[model samples]
Target: MSLLEHLEELRRRLIHSVIYLVVGFFVAYGFHEKIYQLMQAPITFALKKHNLPTQLVIHNPVDGFNMYLKISFMVGCIVAAPLILYQVWLFISPGLYKNEKRYVMPFMVATITLFLSGAFFGYRWVFPGSLDFLFAYSHEFRPLIEVNEYTDLFLTVILGLGISFELPILVLFLSLFGIVSPKFLWKNIKFAILIVFIIAAIITPTPDPLTMCVFAAPLLFLYLLSIGVSFMVHPARRKRLKEAA
Candidate 1:
């Protein structure tokens, strides 16, 4: 395809993705209350555990509606994630061989599964722990968390973890395209570990080492897994090495 055609195709895919997201947004908005409750559950539980107030404050007159809208948008993205990933695959599949294009289903499934798993992990484990740690300071300063601020932080952690969990899939694609190799990843393992810890520290909501470790450990494992996946799928290099041997 010409450059213009490629650009047009990308535009089309983006339009489709937007349409899907809009549809998902309306659907999610219909259940915005429930979604907000779910999102607030961790903080609520933490507050209860700490004997603090369970309610979050809304400072502005429009804060309530804005928070609902934000929650709806976030839930919509989660709902449309599979379709968005499918559009991404379709956009790139033109460059892939027929056999490679057949992996689209697996790619979409893995992407969605890993994303949801990471979001769930953040909500279930990390968010509660972080909230507990933060609320512990309420004795010094009264806690009156705003709804918008709370949701913003909540979504940031969830989305960050969700994207981080895609490390293996990203490496798999790079290896499949001969862009990276298992040996290269292994040689850079130390640097990768350092970067992973740095990212974990940045993304974890709490300053506690335990929370940071919780975030880093899985990422470290995923990096190792990505190396194994790269080794398995890099048949061209493997064949070349075999011939040399």
Candidate 2:
């Protein structure tokens, strides 16, 4: 395909993705209250564990509606994630060989699964723990967290975790495209570790060592896993081994 054709195809895919997101948005909006309750569970649990007030505050008159809208939008994005991923694959599949293109199902499944797993990990473990730690000072000061602010923080942490968990998928694609190999990753393991810690430090909401370790440990494991994945998928690695055999 010509450059113009590729651009047009990308535009079409984006439009389709947008449509899917919009549909998901409306569906999520219909259950916005339930979604809000679900998201608030972590905070509620934290508050109860700390014996603090379990209610979030609203500073603005429109904060409640705005929060609902935000929650719906987030839920919509999550609902439409598979479609968006499919569109992404469609956009790039034209550049791949038939054999490579056959990975579409696996790619989508892995992407979605990793994302949800990361989100669940954040919500179930990281968020509550972080919230409890941050609110540990409630005995000295009254805690009145605004609904919007809480939502923003929650989304930032959850989304960051979700995106970070895609490291393996990203590495797999890079290996498949011959951009990096298992040997290269293994050789640069030290640098990768340094980068992973830096990213974990940035992504972790708190400066505590434990939280940082929580984020970094999985990432380091994923890096090693990616190296193994690269050994399996990298064309040069396969070719060299085949020749040796």
Model 2 accuracy (lDDT, Cα): 0.89
TM-score of each: 0.92, 0.92
Off by over 4 Å in 1: 235-245
Model 1 Cα lDDT, one tens digit per residue, 1-245: 99999999999999999999999999999999999888888988988887888989988899999999988988898899889989999998887656567888988888888888888889888888888888885567778889999888998899999999999999988997899999999999999999999999888887888899999998899899999989977868656666896
State the displacement of the C-alpha of residue 148, model 1, in Å, after optimal TM-score superposition: 0.8
Cα error of candidate 1 at position 18, Å: 1.2
**Taking the tens digit of each residue's C-alpha lDDT, what string does model 2 give over 89-187?**
999888766767888999899999888888888999988888888888445787888999989989998998898899899998898789998999999
- Which 10 residues in a row give candidate 2 its minimum summed lDDT? 134-143
Estimate the Cα RMSD of every predicted model relative to the unseen true structure.
Answer: 2.6, 2.1
Q: Output the lDDT of residue 114, model 2.
A: 86
